[model samples]
Target: MEAQHTPDEKIVKIEKTILRGTRPRSIGYNARKGTHGPCITDVVVRLHTDSGAWGIGPANISQEKAKGLLGSKINEIFKLPFGAFGEGIKLDLPLWDLTARILNLPLYRLLGARGKRDVQLYDASIYIDDLNLNDRQAVSLFKEEVYSGIEHGYHNFKIKVGRGSRWMEPKEGIRRDALVVRTVRETSPAGSKIMIDANMGGTLNSTLELIRLCAEYDLYWFEEPFAEDKLLNLALKSHLIDSDSKLLIADGEFHPPNYFFELVEEGLVDVVQHDFSDYGITWWRSTAAKLESWDALCAPHTWGSYIERYHHAHFAASIPNYALLEASPGKMPGIIEDGWEMKNSRLHVPNTPGAGITIEKKIFDQGLDDRSAFSLSI
Candidate 1:
């Protein structure tokens, strides 16, 4: 793939689409914040070049003014300070897509990843926050959710623990934590994998208790058992826990790529779960390579519509020690008319040019007409 661009290759137009009609779906409680809220809105970014070729990507940045990007070379635009641009480095995805398309190559080809690879995908439901339920009722609800995931061919499953909500007191919270893990262990297929995400809600002592109680179930990994900001405590607790029981630790979903490196160097986690949308495709390519050097696994944290999932699959196809791709069971309808396929519990890579996304413009237009779509004007 060509890395250098000609002088005439200038970005002419930049359009940002904010999608918000996705009905609020209550996901598992986020232990780090101690609550869950409305479903996340998505930002679709389109980078149009002078060549009349355009590339689209999902980003966390907002671009309300298109003229700001007018008549500048794509590489020059990416070099501007992200804060002033209303976007992060993630904007590079569209630029990269546009560049790859202009060069007539797939995005993965530019990233040095081969054709599609089978990515082991896990359904991230089974949250333990049924406020209507007592301990028994909560366990029952978790079992139902896990069973549904299993029937859908997911070989691995993740459940929220730490009971971060006030609905369960401290003692009761600890008790229910054990119950939920036990229930998942009993209900899942014998060789299947189970992961627990504490969302950084647990105190070191309480989290230790919870881990010991449920350690016999052969958990694939324990995720963010403590708050992310407490790096010292996280490292101390993770080391103690790993020494006691062989449970692999996973975290770093909320941190930037640089800080995530701290977690790896300090031995705070066994697996790193960073989001490509937050950092960008180039960051992930380099970060995944760095993690491999540290002998760690990369499980890119993903949540959003089908388009975002497609992006994850494309990048995941490159990582050698990719742990598992996260698939949130919650998704808005009709966001993506057609794209990649999820079969036998694996997210197969897409071979389409550019980002391989097919947005249902009509559905998005309906969202706009109904005022359900959010417009992130700069």
Candidate 2:
């Protein structure tokens, strides 16, 4: 039998565009960080082929590097199952999108459709909104946020804890952290999943105390209670076991060190949360395989870009060991996304080809107005 032939399409042009994202509400302080303003900007790179097929995704490479790929063939730069190779690895997202569109398959299907299409998602916007309020007011705000998430079809909420690390007195901070967790638990619907993130702002003793205070609330996970340390994480894991708490220990978001995987290998961490956009899909694909063997779950971080959130959704649909995705509900102007809907606390991954999103022409034109976009052609 003759070998199967593939498309000989060459990348004709590449364009880099900027998109502005706005959150529904202004994000407040976290364990260690200050207010996250209401808006953020994302830079995305789009690849156009001579065959009229194109793909787009979050951009991380320099314009010079992108220019070097101007004349590369689609098949030469990207392949199925293994994805982009060598220099093409920098263009992972766009290449994957382009290849999937060429195959007429959705991104997840192109990745083998190893998991379900309706991926579970959790609201990741619950921050420390109680910094300036009284106990009653703080609780009231927390309740309002929970109700809002429920209204928006999100049943899982991740609350930012560890107020004592920076804002208030140590004792008072722990007290407020417990208060916020309890308020969310009391206000949300039954069976709502609650997770808390400390952003590595607490010490081991303080973390343990906070956990004890919220013991009856049934948290889904304790994220970054402190930095990732072998002894500290091991002790925390032991305490959870000793107390018979079901809360999972999660870390690795803050530029995880080299020994991070060793922590997973020893069963100290229950969930792995490397940032999806920073690490890209190719890394996650390989990392997820390793985590699967180690009996750990993957829930890649999706905090800033709504575009990256979709990337994580497709990844979740393609991986069997994925935990729920972190959702930051908002609007991304200039982007036309289709087939993505939230129902019953789950975000349905679109069956459309190439990430299920297209750039609006008007928005694309406006982005080009400033002449900041980089473009290259044959």
Candidate 3:
């Protein structure tokens, strides 16, 4: 008879680091978000096992809430239902990292993914409501940003439309949205892909108008044309739009699995944008597999700092259906140890185990000096 060996580790500590930084100069305005040039405020989390192995993840969770894990065996923790403490994806990430490290495997491999050395990435520029620029000026600025992205070898680009923020009038917003697409299509290299995100910012009427306008430029996709609740409307709009134009919608982020799978089963959107920070490793792995079976594609939403970007890249590298990984590349540099650079418009996956990037201790130390910085320990 084979003897069973006892597992040696338990998750003993959980900590969250709050960091404040400036936005990258390249980022533009979102009328819906109503910010000119906003400062960055985000949280990074860490989990320590009894055996001295540790794992790190992003997204914020309350320290008191995480204390529920204290004194629990590792397996017990894993067996608990997701979001049991209302912590959501923030808790799942560190736990997955811990499990992978304990098994001496990379996070992606543990999730049954064969990591790709290079994953194609997209530059998210060309904000339609830059508050600072008029229609013509916005177009010119967008052209410049697109050229800069091309210079960096990025062939896929995303632009935000439905501008009429607090700054621009409704009529001006519509004009700018049309101009943004035309400008990018005209300026990009041959075969460059252009994607526009409405962010649920446009009315159904205006969104359909933009969809009609977008067909002329051969747009790659239209994102979140309406709200998440308007699934039927989105499906109808998808049918009404040019067959060539894809509808990209983000769902199943920071929520349970039921709705995410439902969206896929209903065929509401052509492309589903999944944010790992919101879905965590385990849930995301299952969702990705379902997407594959359903013939749907996933593009990871990368809106965080370098560490989070690396996490998204690793996930993208593992999945064959993903054609583009969203990238922000915000202002803070040297926050992570893995020298992240775009080569031929793609990021090379980190070969290390777990999430594959080391947080810069000095950066964390500096963050501690900020008034907003705080840590939770148990």
Candidate 4:
């Protein structure tokens, strides 16, 4: 008979990690009307495990901070959780306060994810939201992102739409979006899934119209068709979409937790998003439990570092109702895919014990340091 490994025997220590990173120049690609911007900057965190495994996490800073200000306070100063940074900061910060002491980036991520072992991540394609761009340019941008995603061996893609898309336009916002959808769908290999997001930009009339329009495409899910506060509108949408056939997803981001809770109880939400940036890992984990009980699937709103992805992955993987994790690149292109990639859509969770991702020393050197962070027990 095989021997069972006891929990006490395998359990290890926990520690906190703070990661500092920078994207000196921001690059933006909007597919709608072919508009790209140069204003993206990022802060990354990683947790390290006692056994040396690592997970990756990223945090979002406003565009205002990283704009054209080289050698700015962005990296030269390290603000504590409740330090000089005023009320705008996430006051009860747990992880960042701990990991900042260490020099290793990936080492930090492994630890933050509660040492979950490994995380297989999904690729979230870049955004090109300029609807003003010509169709040809839109198609080209779609193909470009698709190419990049395919190169990374990813089979899923997301398209951003719906600012005034809810408006009843002569051009038909849903129809226009359909063109973008069809274009992207054509570029992928068979069996690939496509999702569309409105970014909370439409109205009641427009949302219903787009939802119906999306139905034609057979999408994997439709996210935030109405603004976060449109409870009545969401209720109406719930009435519109029969949950079993397709998903009417409401992300627990930008929107409040109460809204998600109510929606889940009513069986109105098929899929809901859980964001760590807004709630940290603890709150999101609890939210995951609630959603799981209701038989609702979850996808994390992963907008920051790869470490954030690791945190999301743990919740996404542990839940049986986990749909697809929120996918995107927290670092520059090709950083995680080359040496750190997983095979056949399955990424090896950080095996080094903690977060499992490793950052190249040269790249770490290039990262901006807003002072330095102190470490702690996770």
Candidate 5:
């Protein structure tokens, strides 16, 4: 008969590596940041146990901080349901991955699997590509990108706005913003969902004006038109109601103050988008529970890393009030992922154990030579 192993596994070693990859195309500017560039980098950590079990995830913990956790038991760092606490919080993703693997369950199943395995996703790569092009050229580029996303299995898109806030004249920026929205709406197939984000770069007046121009286009939501201000959000909500527009207001990705939840409670914010990696799975579970009562939904911002997108997919599969996930739409070299599938705009989470991803040791080693990496042991 096979013997059962207890949960008291001791951490024996930690391997930290760097992954560098590229987007499908060069990401242009947003309301605030400059060219996003084509390449991306992520710091990943792999945890090994004395019993030969191991798990890995994207994390940026320092050697000093990680060295202190070398000999700790797995149970001391992470627990089911509530996740990592105390110093273990820094190792949230790796710990969750390790625990789920130890139990031989998929991460979503480990989180209770209250939601569907397939979760809806929106293309988040639409940036301000019209900066140097003429009106016709800009619209053409936008159309091409949208079609490419469609070809890649996306039915919804999140278009970046607020060009007037940084790149162009205020009025022209708004006009161009409306033009892009209209072009995307008209070009995409019927029933396609469109959401706009200003990255907190617009004023109330500009937002309302853009809304008025695209009222008939049927937008899914308007995100971060401006920084988090209760009065501004209230006014925006009131305007959305008075205008009879179904556009939801989405924010909170920048780690807003505590009052943001109060806004959700008051029904002012329609969707909450705390970052998937920044907030971790435990926070998403707990926050989703709180938002359930407030009648708000979570999308959990996932813009940069494709690995983080998988993390969001598992979390989305485990929550009921999740609205939609932000899709990065790119590839990470040396990362081998299995089971998860994308059809149309929804991501079907893999039933496989431990996030369903592994690193190719040969490719990983080759890539790590030119990038930043480290290791620690007990």
Candidate 6:
């Protein structure tokens, strides 16, 4: 994204751009394969705007799933405007996430966020392989797999558990659940913070009990430990705790742009997780604007094509209410692996442009459909 305009503040003009492709198709488990898993077959392009003196913005796509309505419409997308700079960063994932980032760098700079030194960030792992990985070994197993992340400078952690109900009960699931936390805490730096995700894995009784057990571990927060539509259950569960555990996250499956509203307006979540693969960046940006004053830390959910994750880096780097960016187990491929290196416990922001990586023509040719339907704008 580039720009030119306005004398009042700064002048920069931005034009819409498109980056399209057939995304990667991967179907496997904790080392196995499933009957039929979702595959993302398109690329997400973010937007950027500049003031006469600088450039800024967020993503236009959050999570990029090959199975969704947006995925099928990969031929195009647009950005949120910036009549006002540094305003309305989102807490949920959406397409505008891309546009906002390019714009964010400059706005945040003006707002006193000088990038990494000004703020330290760590990526949280959203989903986990529960089928192959046993609940009993959840934490220890998590540690074993993410050791590289620890080594790579990630300290904040998140675990996914909706895959099964083993973690839903206090008497039955708490043992294994506790073990997961114990093992992670034991193996991680003493100061390392932890987040657990239940993905609505329990009954009201079970969720409440599990929450208490989680409280004992000095956890950073718990995510979606109850069912999505269980409003009453969530209400009853809400009354069970007296302490402010920092947050109760909800990564409700594909709630889209309404995800944040449902979670926040209902007083259900303290932290919200949205991905480029799911909501597209437009929704993420609008939600950010709505959520900015609420004091909620929006962590963008991620797991898909390299560019999506690459796009999220700037997303996390740009927003104010931004809490964490989802970091995959691998060193993120492409330029992140080749150009910059992690410093401390966070990803080093790239000084390069548009993801800082050159796409292999073949990857696009082999991964995407060549028809006009797959063509994008810029």
The best candidate in terms of TM-score: 5
- lDDT string for model 6 (226-319, tens) is 6565474356436644454544555543453444466576566666776654554445555666667665667766654435554455545556
lDDT of each: 0.66, 0.85, 0.65, 0.49, 0.86, 0.45
Model 1 lDDT per residue over 242-263, tens place: 6676677888776544565776
Of 2 and 3, the candidate ranking higher by lDDT = 2
Stretches of candidate 6 exceeding 4 Å from the true structure: 1-142, 162-170, 229-237, 256-263, 331-340, 361-378
Indicate the TM-score of model 4.
Answer: 0.66
1-378 per-residue lDDT for model 2 (tens digits): 122234569999988877777877899999888999788677788898998999888877777898888889977877657777778888888888888788777888777678888988899999988888999999888888888888778888999998999999999999999999999899988898889999999999999999999999989999999988899989999998998888898988997878999999999998999988777788889999999999999988878777776767888899899988988667888778878887989889998986888889888766655456776787
- Clashes found in each candidate (C-alpha, N, C closer than 3 A): 1, 0, 0, 62, 0, 67
Model 2 RMSD vs true structure: 2.2
lDDT of 4 by residue, 236-278 (tens): 5555655444645655655554555787666766677756566
Off by over 4 Å in 4: 1-122, 129-132, 163-172, 229-244, 329-340, 360-368, 371-378
TM-score sort, best first: 5, 2, 1, 3, 4, 6
TM-score of each: 0.82, 0.95, 0.82, 0.66, 0.96, 0.63
> Which scores greater on lDDT, model 2 or model 4?
2
Which portions of model 5 miss their true places by more than 4 Å? Answer: 1-6
Kindly report which residue stretches of model 2 are placed more than 4 angstroms away from their true locations once superposed.
1-8, 370-372
Better of 4 and 6 by lDDT: 4
lDDT value for candidate 1?
0.66
* Model 3, residue pairs in steric clash: none
Model 2 — TM-score against the truth?
Answer: 0.95
Off by over 4 Å in 3: 1-8, 36-38, 79-89, 129-135, 151-153, 164-171, 228-263, 339-341, 369-378
Q: In model 3, how large is the Cα lDDT of residue 267?
A: 67
